[model samples]
Structures are given as C-alpha cells and as structure tokens.
Target: MSVNVITYDVGTTGIKTCIFEISDTIKLITAAVEGYQLYIEENGGAEQDLKEIWNAMCSTTIKVIDNSKISPGSIQGISFCSQMQGLVLVDKNGEPVRRLMSYMDQRARRELKEGMGNGLKISGVNFLKLLKSIKITGAVAASVKDPVWKYNWVKRNEPENFKRVHKWLDVKEYLIFKCTGNFIMTKDSAFGTMLFDIRKGKNCFSSKMCKLLGVNMEHLPQIAGCSDKVGLLTEKAAVQLHLKAGTPVFGGGGDASLIGVGAGAVSMGSTHIYSGTSGWVSTVVNKRVLDITSMIASIIGADDNSYNYFAELETAGKCLEWVKNHLALDEINIYLQKICVSDSLESLYVNLYDFMLEEIKNIPAGSHGVIFTPWLHGNRCPFEDSLARGMFFNISLETGKRDLIHAVMEGICYHLRWQLEAQRKKIKTSKAIRFVGGGALSPLTCQTMSDILGCEIETVDSPQNAGALGAAVIVAVGLGILERMEDADKLIKVKEVYVPNTANKEIHDRNFIVFKSLYKNNKRAFRIINK
Candidate 1:
C-alpha cells in the first residue's frame, strides 16, 4: 500500500498544504490552500498573528484532506517548510506573549543598535554586522538577547502583552507545538535567526549577548534537523486537521532549502532560481563554501553537511505586477496572449513588459550604456544595503519603456550573476540552473536569464508549488517511502528546459558591464537620500 503524505508550507503571506501518494514513485494526489494577510505598522515593522496563521494551516490541511478521495488513515507522516527567522513569544501555558515579529520587522533594529553600542551604525545593516561579530557557532542560534530585545521593546511599549509573556519560539517550532504539543526547532530555520554560527553545526549562544539582552536560552526549544520526527500529532490536532492520531510530525527546514530539494538542486553544482514575490538564485554546495565578497553562503538544506549559496534581488514579479496594475491594467490579457501568439516573430502588442523587453533587447549586452539598479526593496545578499535605491544611468529620451523594462530584468539578473560569479570562485563546479516559482512561467524571463547567465534554465512541470512539493518530499523521506532524498529527486521531473541563445548572450554581456557601473556611481547618492 502506498503511504499518504501531507506537507505544509507556513509562509508569511499564507499557509499552503499538499497531499502526495508515496509508492515506488512519489505522486502528487492533491494540493491546495487559503491565504492570510500580514499586518504592517510604522517604521518597517511587519507582523502576523500566530493564531490566525495556525488556524489557516489547520483549515487548509482539513480542506485538502476533505476534498481528497484517499483515506486519511493511510497518511504516514506530516511535515512543514516554513519562512525562516520570524520570532514568536509564548507563555508557560503555551499562550502567545506577543505578536510574532516577522523577519521583515525592523523593530529589533533599535535594540540591535543599543546592544552593539558605538560600533553599530545604521539600523538593519548594523544588526547584521553585530550578528557576525558575536560569531555564535551552532546549527542554530537563538539570540536570547535579540528576541528579548524585541520582546522588551514590546513590553516597554505595548505593556499589556509584555507582562503576559513566558516563553519565546521561532514560528516553525511554535506551529509544531500547536499541532503536536511539542516545542522544537529545526536547524535550517534556526540558522537564519542571525543567532546561529555558520562555522560550527551547533547552537551556541554567547554569555555577552545574553547578558546585554537579558534573555535566558532555556526558554527556547531544543533544535533538530528537518528529517527528525519532532512528535506525533495529538488527538485534537488530528481531529481538527482530518488526520489519524499519532501521525509522525517531522521537523522541516526553511523554504529555500526545501525549494532546492523541490527543484532537484540538492546536490553540488545544482542551481535553482525561485522568482515569486522576490527573486532568488540558489545552489547547493557539498560543503560550506563561503563567499567573502557576496556573503552568499546560507545553510539551505535540512542536513548539516550541505550549504545553500543563495543570492536574491527583491521585487521581480512584484515589479511586473506593479507595472501591470498601474500602467497596463486594461490590456493585461492581451499582452499575455501576444506572448503565445508569436512563436516565430516578435510580439506586435506593446505590453508594458514586452515594450520594456524589446527596448532592453535592443540595447546591446549591457543596456547600451544604460544601467539599472533593481533596489526596489532595498537589497539583501551581495550587497546588504537597505538604503540602496533603484537607478537608471546613461539614459536619454531615446530610452523607451522597453529599455527601462529590460534594464529592470537585466539589473535583477546582474545581481544574481554577481552572486553566482562569487560562488564559482568558491565552488569549482556548478550545474545547469532550474527555474521555479511564478516568474518561471514567463518564457521571456527564463530565456533572458539564460542569455545573461550563459546557462540553460530548466523548470519543473509544476513550478508555483515547488516549496509545498519539497515539504512533501520531506514527509516521504521521513516515512521511509524513499531511501534517500536523491531518490525523491529522480522521481521529480522537469517539464522543460530553456536553453540560452548564443546570439542573445553577446548582447547581454555589453549591458551587464554598464549595469555594474550604475551602482558604483549612485551608491553615495542613495546613502545621501536615506540620510
């Protein structure tokens, strides 16, 4: 009999669940979910209600199971793939002490500066520098201080909620606690908290950090790997989720690492590109390959042995959506239709994106003396400048919408290329790139990536749900249905490969040169504006 596996991706925007049949070959039976909204406040503070998030997860799980024809009794295990670095506080009775502090939340920025003293400069940037300075070593690091810093901020400010607090947990661990009545953290999720030491695969919190922040490490849950079974689902949780009691709950990793698995980018040389709300260029490394220049080495996989060098440029698809909503709302479908209408010829309809692409395509390899910096959401890897803003240099009235569009695309690709180039210096071999997420659906974008990166981009048959599928892979592995993760990888198939056109490569090369200089010229200007 085939084992039925259910996996959940607890994301910032919403909760997604997938049900898969695990036999000789893993098969996706059904996958669906509902979404939740994020609560944003003043000063770059973003948060989510834990109760609503958990309810959404449970509701989605129940919905998937209720809609499925397969019996729930056959489910062997359930696992999770969650957003990394969000902090949640709970009391002794397992009640929330405060609103969950999302990774995007910058309230900790003030605390980070105060804790770091005169050495700290800016808000977010200084926080990262202070994290590096502490040099905490472990697979996971729970900054008793950082969380407390944010927690105390809430206490001093909010007052009402702070007094009610008891224990603090990462979002993933908190979700597990809700389902299985267990408090545990995964290495992958823990590593992203800036509390963990990348050098050593352990959870080492510093006394100095603890003293400054006044947080006790004991309040944090024990840490484990993605494959490890955290606990069995309780009767209440099983009933609510429409699953059998005692189903194994596996500790899952961060979405990025699992995405690597979903894209079959698990082994060394395997590269995966996920372009959704944000865009990322990620590759798995057999060993830790740190890029001093880019700061791109992140532990992506559940296993401690491997690392994920991920570089991201925010607002790829989001930017396009912005354009569609603002500039070309009326002719959106017409533009989409034009993309498929002409296989042999260029599109006739001048959709905002197509118009942009055409101009970009015409502007030689590097946007023809035109350079665009895609710092729409600031920046993360390769350049961790929050003050960084978008720029277009060497522009003339001749620069059309097409030129601007292509510049945006090329600028994002340039950021990815910079990270990849850094990775190449550390890792001798890299594999063909696999494209996943909503952005992968765009043939033009895929081809453009190939043209710029000089590598074929392969996309899985189902790209949008790679993260959920990866969570399913974890369930399959935990249930002993698959002997190894690579077995799961083999069963996972790619739908198409977008090979790079040699002709377009030369054009992108010229544009890339100018793209690099745009940032150099505007870096000071960006800081000045921020100041």
Candidate 2:
C-alpha cells in the first residue's frame, strides 16, 4: 500500500542514489553512490566515460535498494537529475559511441565562433551594458558548446563513431535510456543545449546556428516534459537494481533547475544560488524574457511554459580547493582552526584564499580600490569569452590578505549582482535569493553574500542534497504520489537564514565599483598573457 521512490542524481563527480517512501510523512530509507573521474584534455576540453558513469549509476542504484532493505516490487517509480549540457552519442543498438563530452568542455569554441559569425553580438542591447548586467563567466555566450557542436566534432574528427551513431542525448536522457530502455529528452534538460527554442517549447536546431553547423534535428531525441513517463524499467534493469520492471520512469531535469525546485524557488523573482564545484545564480520567470544581450534564459523548471534565467560562475568551490591544495596544503587545518581560534589571523591575510576572505571581510563594504575578475575557467553568461582570464586591479603592497580575500568574494558577488540586475530589468519583479549547494553551508559566505547583495540569503535544509531530493520529488509526482509541484515545499524545509549586516554594506558598495572596472582595465593584459 506504501509507495517507494528511488532517485538518482548523475553529477559531475559521481552518482548519488536515494530511496524514499512517499506518504503523509516523507522518509528517506537509504542513500548510496559510486564515483567517476572527470577527464580534462588539452585546450580546456573536459569529458567523462559514459560506460563507466552508467556502471556507477547501476551500482549506486542497487546499493540504495540493498541498503533500504526494501523489495524491488515496492518501488512505484524511479527518476533522475543530471548535470546539464553534456553530449552523449549512441549507436544504432543504443550503445554509447564514445566518451561523453562534459558541460565544461571547450572544444566547441570554433563552432561557436563560426555559428555566431563576426565574434559575439547581442541583437538589441549595448554589449558593454549587457556584459555588466549578466553573469559573465568565461563559459556563457562563448560559442555553441552544446551537444550539437560536440556531435559535429565527433563526426568530423571521428568519422567511424559518427557513422555508427543513431541518436544524440544529453546526460539525463542517456541515463533514462540506460535504465528504462527509452530514448527521450526532457524539455528542462534540452533547453540548456542551445538546440531548443525556449519560447516555443520545441527543438530549435533549425535556427541559423544549427544550419551553420550542418546539424540535423533528427539526430537528437524527442523532447518531453519532466513529469512525462518515458517508460518502465526493463526486466534486466529491474532485476539488477531491485525494482519492478514496470516501475514508471519520469524525465528528470538538470541539477540546476531541480535545485531550484528542491529549494522552494518556484515563484517568479525568487533566486537560488548553488555553489558546489561550480556556482550558479538562477531565478524562475513566468515567460521567456529574451535579453538580446546579457545572461542566458534557458527552459528549466516544469516546461517551456516557464523560464529560468541564470548567471553562472564555473569555479567557486574549485577555486577554494585550488588554494587549499596548492597554496596552503599544510595550513588547511590550521586555517580552518583559525576561524575559531586566532583573532589576528581573522583580520588580514594574502594569498588567494586569505586575500579573498579578508577583502570579503573588510575593504569598507566593498574592495574600496580593488576588484577581481574570476576567469579561472573563463567566463559564462554575460560575456561568453573562452580566452578570458582572471585579474585583480589597483593592488598595493599595503593591501593585505584581508583586502584581497574580501575582493575575491566581493568580485564573485558583484558578478552575481550583475546577473540579478539583468534578470530584474527584464522580468521587473525579481527578488528573494536562496543559497543552495555546498557553499551555502558557510554562514560567513552566506552573510557576506547577503551584505554585498543587500538581500537576505536563506539556506534550505539538506543544501548539499537538494538536487537529489528534487529528482525524487519529480518521481513522486510522476507516480501519482504527490498532487502538484508546489506541494514539495511542505515536504521540504529550510534549515537556516543569513540576513545582511548593514554595518558592512558601505564597505561592500565601495569595493563594487572597483570590481566593475577590473574587466575593462585588464582585458588587453589578459589577452596578451593568454596569447
């Protein structure tokens, strides 16, 4: 009489599976997972072995079933949430043709250039104003890096693989096929590929961009809604994962969109910030507000009926890890302990982490005379430039780690603010920011974000696992266990809130001006150095 739902989150680093019972009281029975490696090749390209990831998914699913001590027949449905935009090609027999190209892969740079023609151009807005408005991580607007481009790359570079390929899939759809023996793309996942028309809720590969690349829309899978049932688990999959063969499978979405749902960020003007390996600031809109310039407006949430505008930063936690591993490897515990012990160490320090922390701490509400452009992996959203790199300006030896630290955090915040401003301008009612993902765990970071942005930052319960929970909620809806998407808020709860400290607002405001100027002042220098 009870319904069990199993959800899998195919993430950048690994696969996580959670088994839960859907009833008046939602209960998590068990969680399990297996890890995978991320391959980064030359020229900023990143990839993952599709077969290996699938194996991990299967392994994790079985592990969760076993851990839950529940029989396969008890599960009514299974669903997934996956990293967005990765390209996977399959043979006629539904076997992978090659390794999946990850969202981070930059091999499509040339394709983007050729597709856009004459560098990057915004249709109706000032390029500079647009750049300052959207989240300008090096990745956004850089070029056509969707599966279409990657598929073409394979066709040109590896003709044999292309010849054997029958259908192309994003990460989520591929995983669905592997589990349910169905080949379908969810609208939420397809929207991010740049191959779908967010406005019309249909595949938009026919746009000038696809024509330029000689891509056929037929090569991609048919798009479906997130709640649409693609198929039931096959006998083999059911037996292997301890689930019923006829168990329904719903089309899951990108982790970003699901995170929004899981965090109760369903209404218009509500923003959600996810900071894991990378970071993103996303807000839902009732309809498409296509800014001829600025941030990306992708179809997320339930369908093309709604829109999710995002300004993403590619490396927030990753940058912190880089500093921890390379710069202060020996002082990690020491620095972490200092947060609770040493008062002087709290005041100022330099190096990437220390400087970033301090500038975020002091620098008179903003980095008074400093700004940092985070281009560790290039920019996304507003200014799509792959060749772009990071920079810090107006630095003096007098500037200690505190100032630098504050500058780094403030710099990232400034970019987030840029995204918020752009979305607000287009949507007119955008407000409320919710922080999710791993970075949201830090009270200090959340407080800093609230102060710099002058908005309240709320951390949802289970911040780290919101995406996985979101996937489960989708499954619950698909299986007829939950009545509506909005009902999820009652099932989910927020754990904490970080309000702005007006005392630091003045300093943050001052530093924001410097942060805004870094890109302009250092553009030529960055290009030269990269050259």
Candidate 3:
C-alpha cells in the first residue's frame, strides 16, 4: 500500500513543499513553492521576518495538498530539509523575539573578535578556546557568521529581546514548533551550532562546551534524530495548512545531511554536489573529518554512525538570479519583444533562464579572458569573507554581453572545482560526483562542471527537488515504509551523466588558477571598500 507524505525543503529565499506517494517506489504527486524576502542592512546584517517565513510555508503546504487532491487523512506525515546555521530565537509561546538572523548575516564581527579572537591566537582563533571547543564539540566557532556569534550579538545589541529567549532554534526547528508545538532540535542542526559534544554527548547538549562558549544552557532544546517522531501536527497548524491534526511530524534534518540521501549519495565516500539558492559539496564518511583550515567540517548526518564532509557556497544559482535581474533585463524585455513569440509575458519570465543559457551555448570555453565572480552575497567554504563582492575581471571592449554571461557560469564552475580540490586534501571524493539542484537542469552547467572539475557528473531525476525527495525518504523511514536511508539508493537512480570534455580542459584549468588568485590578491581591497 502507498502512503503519502509531505516534505518541506525550506531554503533561504523560499519553501518548496512536495507531497510524495511512498510504497514500492517514491513518486512525487505534486509540489508548491512560495518565496519570502531576506532583509539586508548596511551594517552587514541579513534578516527575515518570522511571520513572513511561516506564512510562506503555510501557503505552500496548503497549495501542495490542494493541488495534489490528497485527502487530509491520507497524508501520513511531514518532515523538513532546510538551510542550516540560521538563528531563530523563540519565546515560550514559540514566537520570535526578533527578526531571524540569516546564515548569510555577518554583522557579528565585533562579537566574534571579542569572544574568540582575544589575547593569543593560532590560525585566526584563540588557541585555548579552540582547543577546548575542539575537545568538546569537534569544531570551533571561527567564522563571524556562526550562530554562536549571532547569539552573542543579540545578547549585546538587543538585550531586551535576548532576555525573553526561551529556546534557541535553527530555521527548520522553528517551523517544526509551529506544526507540532514541540521544542526540539535535530542532531544535525544542533551540531551546526558548534555546541554539541560529539565525543561524549550521545544525544545530549554538552554543558562543558556551552559554558565555555558563554551560552545559556537553559535555551538549548533537546536533540532528536532525523528519523525520530517529533510529535503530531496540532489542530491550530492543521487548520492553517488544511492537513489532519494527528499526522505525524518527523525529526527532519538539515539540507547538508539529507540532500545526499535524496541524491542516492549515502554510501561511504559517495560525494554529491548541490546548487540551489546556495550550493554545497557533501560526501558521506564512515568517520569524521574536520579541517578547520579549509572550513570543511564533517557533519553528523541522518544516520548516527556516519558523517558528511561538507563544503558550501553562500550563493550559487543565486548568481544566475542576480544576472536575470541586473544584467539580462534588456535581452529579456527587448529581445522577447522583437521575437514576438507566442509564449505569454509570464511564460517568457519563466523561460528567460533557458533563453540565457541557449544564447551563451556557443561561447568559447574560456569566455575569451573575461571572468565574473559569483560572490553576489559574499562567500563561504574554502574561504568565508562577508566583505567579498562579485566582480567582472579582465573585461575588454571586445567582451560582449554573451561572453560576460558565459563567464559568470564558468566562474561558478571554477569555485566548485576549487571546493572539490580543498575537500580532496582531507578525504577521498567519489570518482564521479552526483550533481543535484536547479543548476543540474542546465546541460551547459553539467558539461562545464565536468570539464572544470575533471570528473564525471551525474544528474538524478527531478534534480531540483532533491532536498524534498530527501525529506520524503526520511519520513518513509520514520513511517516504516523504508527500513533505512541506505535503502533509498535502490529507489533513486541517476537519470543522465556528463563526461569531462577533454578539449576544454586546458582553458578551464588556466582560468581556475586565475580564479583562485582573485580573492587572495584583492583581500585587503574588499575589506577596505565593503568594511
């Protein structure tokens, strides 16, 4: 018998809610997406209104259920796979005391410097603090953007809001509270906070680490495994979402842990690369691998026994979105007007990205010496620099619009290659990496990425919905429809593979060497201008 489950893949800008029928095979019945705005401040702050986020999820859930025509009682459960490391401080009533501090927010530099960058230091972190943190939590809070720093920023800046904080939660955990009226953080989300002790906690939050970090232990929620049942959907949430009140709610995990399961990259050493609003390269490992220098930390994934060595890009396909709004306005409006195509203006807006890729398909491999950085919203992984901004380098009068556009795509591929290089230093990556995301839908991206990384790239079916699929897999395990996460590998198969293009290797390699130097060469300039 088939059981229906709804999974929410909540991202930085939006929530994608998908309903799937799980039985002999996992099949997507219907899906709906709703977007919310991320508020940016001049002082390097990025936030989102709490009510806006919850409304998006509610609307999308209702839309998905209504579109699927699935009965409220037929839906068995709900789970989530969302962006990690965001700070959502809630009061006892589960209401936010302040706007959400996005993972992209870096306004905590002062707090980070005072808290972890005092007296003596080793590799940008105070030695004693790093040692104590590493001993207890297997990682240290070095980045100004870490949730701990944001917490400190709140305590110091917004003292009134800080006083009412009943529990600190990640993005998805906050949403889960709305659905089930339970206060719990999944293991992966807790680990993202750099407060959970991997050595001794078992599943408990470590008081030693919490004390060392100067955190309020009273605020930390109980940790839950990804497959554990969180609670049943409450009547209030049920009315809002048009779902059954008693439906089960599972402990859904962060995107870094669950997307690999969706991509069928759950085996040891199996690597999967994702590009969405943000991007990441995660490989499942039997043992933990933490390289503070590279900023690639192995996370406790869905299964208790394993880890995901994860590297991230703060902005990925978001660069393409930037291009659509800023760079390609003329082509989309005037060119479409000239073509006088049968597709409506709304349809044209939906297909504009396809139009951009098709126009740049014939551009040369190297983009004729033009290079564009994909740091529109700063950067993470390999390097974490919030001051960094996107730029077009080596542009000449001869550089046309198409060449500049193609170079942006090439730059994104180059960064992914750089991340893979950094990760390869610590662990053995898969021979051929599975690529899943909205970026995977582009054949040009798949081919270019394979050539740039000098490895094979495989795309799974419905690559854009991989996170939703991953959350559905977790719900299936919780519902007893699947025995374990590994079983998902049998059901999700690769749809197509792109081999490295030998002819384009030299140019790509040459551009990548230049790409690596751009950030290093302009580090001081970035801080001076943006700071």
Alpha-carbon shift of residue 129 in model 2 (angstroms): 22
Best by TM-score: 3
TM-score, one value per model: 0.82, 0.84, 0.97
Candidate 1 lDDT over residue span 218-258, tens digit each: 66567777888889999988888878889889987777778
Summarize candidate 3's per-residue lDDT along 364-419 as a digit string, tens digits: 99999998888887887798788898899999989988898899899888888889
Clashes (N, CA, C under 3 Å) per candidate: 14, 35, 0
lDDT of 2 by residue, 63-136 (tens): 88777788887787788888888888898777888888988787776555454445345653335523432322
User: Model 1, stretches more than 4 Å misplaced?
Assistant: 116-135, 138-160, 197-214, 330-372, 391-407
Candidate 2 is scored at a TM of 0.84
| Candidate 2 error regions (>4 Å) | 118-144, 197-213, 239-242, 298-300, 331-372, 392-410
Clashing pairs in 3: none
Q: Which window of ten consecutive residues has the lowest lDDT sum in model 2?
A: 132-141
RMSD of 2: 6.0
lDDT score, residue 29, model 3? 95
